[model samples]
Target: MSMNTLKRTAQIFLLACCCLTMLVVARSGHKPAPTVDDAAKVTVSNVKFEPRTLTVKAGTTVTWENKEGSHTVTSDTGAFESETLSAGQSFSHKFDKAGRYPYYCTFHGSKGGHDMAGVIVVTK
Candidate 1:
């Protein structure tokens, strides 16, 4: 084939590939999670989390605010975690999957009756 013809063919092929990739991505129907400003708040107070069980949408960001004591939000499956938060401190995480994410305060414990734990229910 002529050089010009080969170059034109390559350009067309590249454009087609780009269009196909965009079509596949659009068909997959994936959306990014919302910003942290739209997050829900959880209150942490003295070895306890108020509203321990929270339900949110798949793209929601959940913010944990320490109202009265120090604590950490550690996920059971290690999906996400936060450093120790003292009074008035806060941490946020975006939930992108639909499942029950159980978390706890590492300093407190995860077993027995005294464990400080919480659950995040993410829905589609």
Candidate 2:
């Protein structure tokens, strides 16, 4: 081959090698974290929990935001609870075990007699 043709061939070969190396490196790289929006979410109008029940890994932090006014995050047994949170207020809970945990709001449960509840299902 002519000197120019040989040099051009070598350059093209180097470019192809570089492109293949980049593809291999990209394929071996770590991926971005999965955006699991299931665990932490907000409640909507009428004191309802959005995705009221969720399944998550143990030790994952779950947050509940009361977008609907005058809501509470009370234990299913009416034990542990949060006071009425107006619009834009929030609450959080963590599940240390694998089971179904249910909760409700006291304010709506007794007066309007409407129960605003949620469940957290934790697993391995």
Candidate 3:
């Protein structure tokens, strides 16, 4: 084969390989998680979470702001939980799977006997 023909073929092969690599690398792009502004939010007011239950897509983060007093976000199923939040404080959880996670306030429950309870419904 001529030198020019061989060089052209090699260039085409290199371009194809580069395209394949680029496609593979681009596939790693993941959709960003939804935040409180985009996903869902729960407010702890008067010793209760306003809108006690909510549904959101997987990978969404839900933020709960304490409006009354110190509170603890304890997962009922024990998969995950958060630390105690003081008044005007906040807690957040990111749901990664499709299921219902029932949770309550550990601190409040001891004193008020189950004053808080909620569920996170995750969808695809």
Candidate 4:
């Protein structure tokens, strides 16, 4: 083959390889790290909190809505508490500090986090 023909073929091959590399990278299922939003919500159904564990940024407010039955969002450390919430009632709390805040339903769980409990992890 002529020198120019060989050079052209090599260039095309390199371009094809670069395109393939980009395609593979796009299909690798790489996801960006999750960003903390200004607020978060959890659902309180019968005998359970929708998300048993949550992570939020310090100063974010979390709201829990009682969707199914009566419950309470009582903190383990007495940092916060809510009245018994019947279906359609809700409670909100602002986590001002970065620490682990565990809570539970008064009727179904205890301070030690028993059957019906959840935890919030606050980050700076």
Model 3: how far residue 54 lies from native, Å: 0.7
lDDT tens per residue, model 2, 5-124? 999999999999999999998998889998865455546457677777778888776787877678777776543567678888887777677777777676665422246667767887
Top TM-score: which candidate number?
Answer: 4
Ranking according to TM-score, highest score first? 4, 2, 1, 3
| lDDT of each residue in 1-124, candidate 4, tens digit only | 9999999999999999999999999998698989858889999986998799999999999999999788999999999999999999999999999999999999999887799999999999
User: lDDT of candidate 1?
Assistant: 0.87
TM, every model:
0.65, 0.66, 0.63, 0.71
Model 4 residue 101 CA deviation in Å: 0.3
* Candidate 1 Cα outliers beyond 4 Å, as residue runs: 1-37, 111-114
Which one wins by TM-score: 2 or 3? 2
| Candidate whose lDDT is highest | 4
> Could you tell me the C-alpha RMSD of candidate 4 in Å?
3.7
> For model 3, which pairs clash?
none
Compared with the true structure, what per-residue lDDT tens digits does model 1 show for residues 51-78? 8899998999999999977789898888
Better of 1 and 2 by lDDT: 1
Give lDDT per model, in order.
0.87, 0.72, 0.79, 0.93
By TM-score, how accurate is candidate 2? Answer: 0.66
